[model samples]
Target: MNLAGLIFVLVTHFLAGRGVMAMFGIKENKRKTLALSMIIGVVLFHFLPVVLEVCHIAITATSISIAIGILTLALFLPVSYKLDYSVLKITRPSFTLYEALFATLLILMVIPSVWLCYYFPVFARDVLSGPEPLAEYAVREHTLINSALSVDLTSTNNHLKPPFILGLQVIYKLLVHPFGELWLSIMVCSFLLMFYTLIRERVHALIVLFIMMLFIMMPEIYGYMYIVLSDYPNMVLFFLAFYYLGKYLETKQANTFYFATFLFCLASSIRSETVVLIGLIVPLLLFSFIKDRIKPGVIALRLGILLVIPYLLYYVWMNVFVANYMHIQFNTGEQLSVTSDSVNIFFDRIGIILGPMLFSEHARELFGYIFNIFLFTLALDLVLWRKKIGLQARVMLYGIVVVLVGLPLLGAIIPWFDINNTTKRGVFKLFPLAAFYMANSPTLLQLSQAIKRFEFPELTAQKNAAPVMAQQQKIKKKK
Candidate 1:
């Protein structure tokens, strides 16, 4: 792997959660936490030679790439698990085989049913393609995707935010065969997992499994799932973290909370910006430990210490060790990126930040901005049951608003719109949380369909209230 890629992986995967978690509630220390995260990145990445040499082995292109991913989970899971037990955090079973069955259908088949309504042409295009369309892009004898647009093996894009998709690429590289059958098989499973996590139903899972299947069936997203890219992987990882966090909230399972936090942090590395979302989980854990008054009947402080200790150690290590090892740079501007445009527009800059809103039909533009805000607020309300959820939400929303607001500022500051591949390609990464904000039941299924039909519900709760009961709609709305 390229040196930059290695560094990207370590900093992004290993330390992102710890970095973001450390900044919770502490305005003054955020930079320090970020600094520490960069440091930790150095320790993990820079130490590769030492680790490889100590084992008397040479790291392969695949092995090293694989190691970065495996190590992240290995490090996160055990410690997060211990933290749960030590904190005596609660636990509840979110799924049995049966519930998961239906959830699976909802996520897999059902969701896709809704998705197919909108992306009909995209799906039709793929279906109408040659029998070997995927073959044209399949991994070749040289161990790379056949397409000209395929990512360069030598490119230093090392941060595998959602490495699962990348792993698929590697698999195809070795298979030396068409990915047509393999694609559908994986799609089936991915849809299953997708729906199972989202709806937790096996029977229903299949319904929505194909929901986004056709949406993602678009050549760009579909191709990358079998090709080499981080989008699908990031999507899956973010979904997993969110799923686990939801489980933790529902059952108060310390295990889920710890794992969720760990996975969320781990997600930061895979996709770089998951740190913003992970930022929310850590503080909620700390506060709930200190202030929630929930009792495990024993080991309350021990659990609190457990919850805080890993984060603290990770922080100290990041700041003192990794940062020093790599001499990582920090940026405060990253935070203000969102609303920079709004503020700029507020100052009457040439370009509009809130687009047409800040002027013209000023109230309407603000309302448009507020429409997203309301979407976010509604989704937040529905999913914001757990304190950790709120914590994650705050961090995610912080970055989301930054982009929503910042692009205008960046546009104003720059002579022209920022159009680098990184800026354009990474636009989605910045809005990971925003995905959650918009995933209401109606929005996910019916409203999306309605949009295809050119309509929206006057009353939202009526449309998108999965996992949320009808009677409790008012409570969630009020919440």
Candidate 2:
């Protein structure tokens, strides 16, 4: 591993992302904005290589470094606009003993995950054949359209998938590590921090820690944290996209909505199938706009923005790049199941996905009790707080449905989309949403408030007395 190169790449991304957040006016607290900056930087930098390739520039170390320098300077050009250092001024919150323990446990898990990512060679078959070799050769040859494309890849279409993974791999392999997957670790850590920031504000610190523990403990999801695959990265971007979308719903902030759309575009760039899922989200966005009583023209325009961007990305990759640039005859129609029993096949796939694949003993081994906890929390909410369930929670539930149904729909349309491999990993998209919903659980929120009251009784008493004192003062004034 090129330790110095890794540090340089990470720092450049952090600073570049920080500059972007500042330029766009996407304000959060210092910590959260920092986390979001890192994530946004990772996704945005993917396009640097794409731009180079479009211009027929070789993806060499010097080229990439120069590009980074140019982008960084461009972002930080406004020297007079002071960067946000308010995080330094804010006092840190005191953690209780239990919160400290939970933090320690999460740190322990993260350390080993990073180590494993650094230690292991590229091993996933999908990656081994596709992005891994392509990236390895692209680094060696300094061109993406290299000798790797000349080989016979009749067995798998993985090579024809979007260049998002290839772009990251090329950058990382050149600048970070030989395996080029430390980007995954960067992504994982940034996402976890941002997630913590989001949830800690709404739930008790202790409960937030517990939720983070459950998230890190999921066997399938945890393994992917280190493993180099597109699914986990896709899940991270997709989840963040919706998180921002929820923020848009709450604040009606254009920047927030555009950020969500940008993340969704990044997610789509990772997997072509993501376009379908984005389509599923359109109705939700449209309904929200209607309820807000926004003009039909503006509503249509915003919905168009959400849907068009992803489709344009999809077309660039699948239609333009793959067909013209690579000269590959990649056909989606050939992958579809057109048999008379296609409907039955779709329903069967759905049943398998929601049934044994979700709840069976084997699934318990793969996912542990995470799904069970989500279902239980969801049922509890439905029974006790169904009417009280807020739009954000409902939006999460809507995402859960979109993924669950969208996967089977994809399987039905694309013959090779199997329940075991593709569908299994596709289910990763749901876990983060589940975690978000769990964070918003009303019972959990109430419990979080009770815990806070118990932990700081004096503060609670002060709060309780203030209202009473005000009432007594009013009576005295009336007399």
Candidate 3:
């Protein structure tokens, strides 16, 4: 049954992704289109069913399946008619021996990580205190409702969470009756695949594979693989949002914007804290408008569709449905204060969070090797390929800084929050973006070039000489 559920999830997500890409007119790169589609599909899977249930529609397996079928056919038919399939064909990338070895090592790492997800227990305190119980309750009710009548297995705060993951769990439970470790396994593995797929599209296969290995090997990530936590899923969604945003900046493509907007909406739905992504995005969008000299009306319309509407919808859903219906306090006032002492405390808390990541032995044991490699490579990339860094890499770097630094500062200032416990988990949301940029550093390209030069110096020399020789020959012919 679990196997069937997994297969079902895979097929559903693929068709859904295909439909989304077709709707958005995204046909630039098949892999990217597929990745974006899967993300959209998953978000829709969780969102559509719950919204239907909320509107008093019966959400049976047949109804859900039929809706998906109609959606796929509706979007796909028109796009298929217009698409030039030959343009979608991507030639397979070749790799050197060193690249092959790195890819193999990463693949090996993925196997054990997937095994760990199945073997481990869902013991994270957050899981027990939050989404898991809510999921169980939703499954039992056969509909989603945030009311006092619901089972009180989890905290009031948990009930107030955006219902994306909980809704997903309900679907999983309904499909696979005895949902145990399989749901988590599916989530973790899907996350791994998404990260790999996105990275592979952007970077070389060898670099992407190495990045995946490092990401899965993170002690915090490995520890939480089986746990039903929002942190990892939030990270994946946020990274995808930023990644597509970066692509939009580079290519000025409408489809990338659509995909990025979809991802940002999905990310925002997972946790209230993910609303911080909006803080990052708004400034970038403004900058793009100015830089591109885009018309004001067009800018406003794009921003409205991408940022304003989605956030407004989430705001209403959370405040009206989740908070009011569940009788959960939407206590913004209690969480922040602007006194001098509070400002000092915030700085102190930032120090506390940074201390472990910067100096602690356990942190060293866990992240030291990867940290050093990333730092060294990043520095090299900046020095060697400053002009080539591109908007995406820069945005991702800024995001990491914001997560590592800004989040801790926010934790410190927030009067009611627990910095010690939440800071670590909060930082987990930045790992996917950090790992990707680290792997894509020009250092990898330089290293690959050096290896090629060492093995086949003549070929390397000829490649370099050809460009200069062509220019020289052209000059001579003109003279």
Supply every candidate's count of residue pairs whose N, Cα or C atoms clash at under 3 angstroms.
Answer: 60, 0, 1
Q: Lowest-lDDT window of 10 residues in candidate 1?
A: 156-165
State candidate 3's TM-score.
Answer: 0.84
* Model 2: per-residue Cα lDDT over 162-200, one tens digit each: 877788888888888888888889899999988887888
Error of 1 at 354 (Å): 7.5
lDDT of 3: 0.66
Residue 201 lDDT (model 3): 58
For residues 167-235, write the lDDT of model 3, one tens digit per residue: 666666656544444545555556665666666655555566567777777776776665566776677
C-alpha local distance difference test of each model: 0.39, 0.85, 0.66
Q: Model 2, residue 217: displacement in angstroms?
A: 0.5
In candidate 3, position 193 carries an lDDT of 59
Work out the TM-score per prediction: 0.40, 0.95, 0.84
Task: Give candidate 2 regions above 4 Å deviation.
Answer: 76-82, 88-93
Check candidate 3 and list the clashing pairs: 17-37
Candidate 3 at residue 89, lDDT?
72
- Model 1 TM-score (2 dp): 0.40
CA displacement after TM-score superposition, residue 106 of candidate 1 (Å): 14
